[model samples]
Target chain A: MKWKLLFELFVVFFKIGPISFGGGYAMIPLIEREIIDKKKWIRSEEVSEVFAIAGTAPGAIAVNAAIFIGYRLAGFLGALAAMIGVLLPTTAIVMLLGSLYFLFKDNALVEGAFLGIRAAVVGLITYAGIKVARTSIIDKPTFILFFLILLSLLFLHLNPILAIFIGALAGILTMTAKKKIQQKREEKTHFQNKQIREISK
Target chain B: MILINLSLLFLFIGVISFGGGFAMIPVIEAEVTKRGWLTTSEYTDIIAVAGMAPGSIASNSATLVGYHVAGVPGAIVSSIAITFPSLILILLIAVSFNKINQSPLFHSIFYGLRPIVTGLILFAAIKFAISNGLIASTFSWQMVILLSIFALSLFVLLYYKAHPVLVILASGIVGAVIFS
Candidate 1:
């Protein structure tokens, strides 16, 4: 049973590893389907939690998820198995593809294929951008921040890192203000309720 | 000497890569271009290949850059080295996830990072768009078709929840048909 579990970890991450085009987030649905939904290796809610952990936890999210999932399934050994399985395919493929790519360096068809790939990649990146915005930008402040950032980037051609730094500072301030407001409201409620309780007693 | 240099270079890449592979672009570009390790076109070709290949773009890009610089050994060393820091950081953080998952301060930090990441993606997208003719002076029917494809793909992705791979394949077919 242990060996079979290890095999399952190996096979699942191995399958996801090479086939994960468009990087970390792009593989989310596929990984969710295979591991959580179909295989029942993990629960749907667990997968979402894993994704959240993966994002904030560091490393590549996909690799992190594989390691966690593997650990969940078969413990430490399973994690090693899964990580190796996932990375092996990509390493092997990159080695082969990189070597062979130079052979067709002058081929126009290859050029065209890459050109098409580039255009498609732009679409993919743009789609990812919109999805990110919808999920992250909720309140008016955040929305306005996003719009201003977009305008600054699109027209002013400001550096993104600077914009991000500004946004981070804004977030800190907003969160601090919101926390203070909530604390004050709670205090006011407590005081009023205390007065009311005294009168009743 | 060469292997050591390559490994160290990739290790640096892994550590500083806060926003993943695409964000590593300018840094890697600077290194390769300044060093004359690869031509500009070669670097762009590598970017395209990394985009198509599996795994993290940063890892894959590291692999390609390494391969071009020093062949198979270079690829191995660089990929492993570049991925090492994040891998270690994640493993350590994974152990503490349950304890720290609900911190407001943590959420706020991410909220801060998200817009920055969005800005980076936006900047990258615009650069790609211009390079690929998303905004151009030339107005061919092909341009119109490409724009429509891009617009439709974004719509499907945002509204219809279409899978990225499917969208990519569809775009490829459309490109082959129209461009050919």
Candidate 2:
């Protein structure tokens, strides 16, 4: 029974692996359909929670998600099976393509194809930038933060690790300050209401 | 030596790659260039291929870089190295997911980190454009072709919401026909 379940896990993820282009986000809906809707492996809400956790965790979102889902279903071994299954197709495909690219890299025809592909890649990356920006740059502070980071990266050539660290620190400091101010305001309002009630009494 | 370095480098990248594969590109570019494994344009080619291929772009690129550096065994090592951190992290998170998710501080950090990630991705876009000659010092026919391709790709992705694989394939066809 255990082996059958493991095999099923492998097969399911292996099937989902190849068609999951455009990164992990693209694979989420398909994973949901197969795991939640079709297989009844987990609830839709649970899947969403998994996604949130996956987003926050380090590594590829897809791999983290697969591990969470697999662990939820059948513990560590199941997680390994799911991860291996999902990774296999892409690994094979990439290895094959990578080898081919190396072999023909100097070919004029191949070079031409890459040139065109590279141009289109610019568009793809730009679209990704805009998509994330739309959701993340929601207000003035975030907008300023965004441009500040951009300038640091573009001109100052800041190390990405340093940038990420600075961003996290700024986030913690600003958010904590905001929360403290909010608490003070609430306390003051509460004190005023209490005084009014005592006077009326 | 190369394998060890590649493994260690990818392992570090995997650990710090917060906003998914796109956010990792600049870091990967920095490392690969610094190591003298590939030139900037060559690395961009890997990025293009990685974008077109399956799985995570970071992993795919790692595998390609490993392969470039040492061969199939090198590829395996680098891929494993890149993936290892996430596996360990996810397992830890799975055990304590409730505690982690309930923290307001966690949410706050992400709120700040998200916009920074957005900026990093945009930087990647600009870097690729400049390196690939999409944004040139002087305008020419090649620039026109590139801009048209860029506009067409952006429109298709935004308006029609076409799958990225299809967009990449279409771009490759356009490249083969016109640029050739």
Docking category of candidate 1: acceptable
Candidate 2 stretches greater than 4 Å from native = A187-201
- Chain A TM-score values, per prediction: 0.67, 0.88
Per-prediction TM-score: 0.76, 0.94
Model 1, A85: alpha-carbon shift in Å?
1.2
What value of lDDT does candidate 1 attain over all alpha carbons? 0.72
Best by lDDT: 2
> After superposing candidate 1, which stretches have Cα over 4 Å from the reference?
A1-12, A23-46, A71-78, A144-170, A181-201, B1-47, B137-146, B155-180
lDDT of 1 by residue, A80-193 (tens): 788777888998887777777777756665655555656666776776566566667777777777778768766886655466567668788878988999999999999999
DockQ by candidate, in order: 0.45, 0.76
